[model samples]
Target: MNILFDVGASGGALLHNASEMDIDLRNVDVIVISHGHYDHTGGLLDALKIINKPTAIIIHPDALALKYAIKPKFRLTGVPHTISEIKKHGGRFLVTHDSVFLTDSVATTGEIKRETDFEKTPEYYMLIRGGKVAQDKLLDDQALVINHEKGLIVITGCAHAGVVNTIRHAQKIFGRRDVYAVIGGFHLIGASDERIEKTVESLIEINPRIVGPCHCTGDKALKIISDNFAGKFTEVRVGTVLNL
Candidate 1:
């Protein structure tokens, strides 16, 4: 199996090199959105138009809505694509609010439960509805787990759910902790020093074979992981592809 469709990555990562990468755009089987952010979802419109088959579009329902911050209140908006819109474009929409399997090899852990008490959600995240704070728990934040021949691989978008939480959920879902690798955004941008330290500690505890932090994982966090994990850490760019 292959990552037929990825996060709505902008700058035409796949769009510019679909053929060279040997990925058949017309045969894409699954499309997984990491979050509602445009940078990860912006390319779906064109991708959908190209895919001839009915591809499964997996996403959390809450992610399609608005996301907000509390401290000083700034806009970090979510993409404005509803399930209906996806269906209109012939997408096989898979709306998930809980852990579910999309296939034998591919499954989503729904919204990962914050298994660790130490890992706390950022305070700035808030759900506003009708000009009211909804205290959204981000129940739809999910990750894709692929059971490869080597070991289980976890692919995430932004990892709004704690990275530790995402891993634990993957372990539970697969009934094992033998993670071959984890790729994609860790969402550790702008994290405090303490948080970064804790995150590094947790990653070392898990000891994944490979950690490819891309997108929102800030440079400082990447450096810390590299300094600690060394050979295990690798850079993930738009054209980068990791095979299990």
Candidate 2:
């Protein structure tokens, strides 16, 4: 049941980190790309080669679309590898917009539904559509859901779909509200204090047994979440592993 989720900024970094953790890339059963972001998918080709065998790579088709960060300056921020390249490197891609069950208790949320008004993906980029620049709805944003014995464990990448929405989507798919843990980027960077506060309150209602916000969760938001979650908050880092 070895699963790799969202490769890091570079393939070398992925390999280095795996080596540090004593993880053999060859044994990974599957690879899941949370979104098309460069940080998440840049190592795809290298990972595929490391596996060197037929492997299922789960991701959304929209992850291939041209993506950019328009602020400060327009910068490309999408997957660096081509679909053909991936296929040539022992990659069996499963691109879809529906839940994909890896196991009876493990699956992806597919396309998360944005139900909260305050929980919106910050305007980071304008995605190309019909040869025109359009607002990125990030419909491809999804998360992994694990039906643990205590409750569901949701893992996200960037969380452009909104963490609450991601969790709720997991709950809907799994038919449970009890979440054991949530560990990943919440994408609350540069968000308003009000939004961060509201998000923490919403999370309190969901009441995950453990909350580990990392990456794009933002420093300010992390402090707020830490303050609100208190005993339940866990500091996540590279090599940090959650048993549940």
Candidate 3:
């Protein structure tokens, strides 16, 4: 079954590019939103339109909450599309706080457990309510786990809950220790040197066959991961497709 982990910032453009590669958007059976961030869910409404058929949208219920990044400057950074808009486009929401199986081999990470002390969500991120801003725990952050022949493949959007945490959660949920690969954002854009080092150390312990860091993963963090993983690291891009 064809599954889209997360639509890019532009749904129309992503569909156009997919068409160029001969990928039919209508074939998509599931759409998983990693988090509520705009960069991840901006194209969701458009994607619903292209699919035309009933598509299951796997996402954490908290994703619908109001969230924003307070650092640098105040701005709206949550999902740009509303629930009504999603329904208007024929998207079926499977909102949940527990792991959801899209098919026999595919599942959602649900809400990842934050076990790492150093990999805390940035304090600058907040959830606004009645003009009162509080720290955003980003509980909506989740990942997609695909069980393959070799091992499990974890696909993330902006991993605000922590990439290591996401991988560990996937392992526990799927009852698989072998992680074939981890693709997508690590959310270490402005992480400290110590945090990056610790994150790499944890990743080494739960070593996967390949690592593809993209989107919100910072240059320093990417470099660190590359240096550690060496040949196992792959550059992830919009048009990049993995056979597994």
Candidate 4:
């Protein structure tokens, strides 16, 4: 079963890349949204329009909540399309906070538990309250766990919950410590040096076979991970594919 994870910043890019890869969007059996961030859900409308079958969209209920980043400037950072817009385009949402088993071998991490002190969500990130701003813990952040024969493959988008925490959650849920690969954002951009070091240390303890950091994983952290992980680190991009 082919599962299409978080759509990129826009439909145009996703469509173009799919075409290049000879992947039919209509053939996609499931759509999983990691969070409600604009970069991840911006192309939902266009994607729903193209898929022919009744695809199930798995996502956290809180992902639909309004979210924003208040550090640099005030701006809307939530999903670009509304639930109505998604439904208007034939998108079927299966929103839940509990871990969902998409298939016998694949499952969602659900709401990741934040147990690490250093991987705390940035204070500047906030959600709009009743005429006020409140810190956004990003409880909606989750990841996809594929239990391959060798080990588990964890895929995430932004990983607002914290990469180490997400990985640990996946391991606990699957009852396995052998992580085959971890692909997607680490969300370590603008993080402090101490936090980055702690994150890397945690990752090393888990010791996945391969690491593919993308999107919001900052340059500094990426370099540090790449250097430490050496041959195991792989850079992921829009068109990159991981063969399980």
Candidate 5:
């Protein structure tokens, strides 16, 4: 099985370009979205147009909404997708706010929950419902976990829910502590040095064989992982692929 990341950039890319990278789009049985950000979901239209066959599209429920915050004067800036538009291509689409099975050996950790007090989503956006603004808990932030014969490999997108928490949730869902590798964005662009250090410490315990940090993880954060976890670190780009 292969995990084809058609849309990984913050924006400005196409799912149709999979052919350019030598990825057989038809072989893809599943399409997993990390979050609701436009850059990630922007290529859905193109992808659905290409994959004419049945394919399961997985994402968090909160991602399908137009959300806003109060402290920031209740501005709406959420990317919400209509069910009709998602199914416009006449393909199978699976929606859920909890974990779902990808294959017999792989599963997607729906929304990584906040298990520790230190790990928290930024308090920037809030949901506006009935003229009431509430804390926007990104309950849709999820990751894909592959139970390989060697060990578990975690695939994440922006990781808005927190990378450490994402890993912990995968561990809880799989009931295993052996994470072979982790690839994708950690969303540490604007994080503090202390937070990054602690996060590194937490991940070090997992002893992942490969750590491919990309997208919004930022240069400084990636450098920290490179310097500290030298043996296992790798940089992720648009055309990166891994065999499982």
Candidate 6:
């Protein structure tokens, strides 16, 4: 099945890329939103219009909740479009909070169970829970797992749930097996030096064949990760493609 992961920050670029790459957006079987963050969900409505059909969209229930950055200037950081807007454009929501498979081998991690001490969530982001505004644990943060013969390929989007924890969650569901690839944002931007160091070390321990960290992963962390992984590291970019 053709699957489109996270719509990106805007429609212009996404649509352009689809056309240029000869990707028929209309044929996308399903679209998965990594989380509620605007950058991850903003292009969804536009994409739905392209599909022009009742397309299934897999997402976390909490992804629809209002989100904000409490400090460094209060700002809305939640999904830019509403349910009504997306539905009007042909989105059929399949919301869930537990790991759900899209295929026999590919699935979403749902809410990652935090397992490490160093990996932490954004303390500045806040969200409404139980009718009270509180710290946004970003429980909606999730990853896509593709079980391969050699191991698993884990893809994450702004892993606010923590990279190590996210990988571990996938491991738990798929059985503790070798990870073939670990890609997507580590979300370590502006994180402490110690945290970055620890995260890189943990990634090395995971020993994935391909390490392509991008998006919100800070430059320092990326450099360290690439350095440590060496020949195994793959640079994630707009035109980058992986055979797996």
Which regions of candidate 6 deviate over 4 angstroms? none
**What is the alpha-carbon lDDT for the whole of candidate 1?**
0.76
Looking at model 6, report the run of 10 residues with the lowest lDDT sum. 121-130
Model 5: lDDT to the true structure = 0.75
- For model 3, the stretches where C-alpha displacement exceeds 4 angstroms are 129-133
List TM-score per model, in order.
0.87, 0.97, 0.94, 0.95, 0.87, 0.97
lDDT of each residue in 94-163, candidate 1, tens digit only: 7677766777877877878887765666666767556677766666677889877777788877787878
lDDT of 5 at 203: 87
At residue 62, candidate 2 shows an lDDT of 81
- Candidate 5 residue-wise lDDT at 242: 71
lDDT of 2 by residue, 114-134 (tens): 899998765767677568887
Candidate 1: the clashing residue pairs are 8-40, 8-41
Better of 1 and 5 by lDDT: 1
Clashes per candidate, residues 3 or more apart or on different chains: 2, 0, 0, 0, 1, 0
Better of 3 and 4 by TM-score: 4
lDDT of each: 0.76, 0.90, 0.87, 0.88, 0.75, 0.90
- The Cα error of candidate 6 at residue 8, in Å, is 0.8
lDDT of 6 by residue, 56-141 (tens): 99899889898999788999999999889998888999999998899998999988999899997868988886688988888898
Pitting candidate 1 against candidate 6, the one with the higher TM-score is: 6
Task: Estimate, for each residue in 46-129, the C-alpha lDDT of model 5 and write its tens digit.
Answer: 666666666677777666666765553755556544567768764465678788876787888987878755567779866654
RMSD to the true structure for each prediction, in A, is 2.6, 1.2, 1.6, 1.6, 2.8, 1.1
lDDT at residue 34 of model 6 (Cα atoms): 89
Clash total of candidate 6: 0
**Candidate 1 — which residues are off by over 4 angstroms?**
9-14, 17-22, 69-73, 128-133
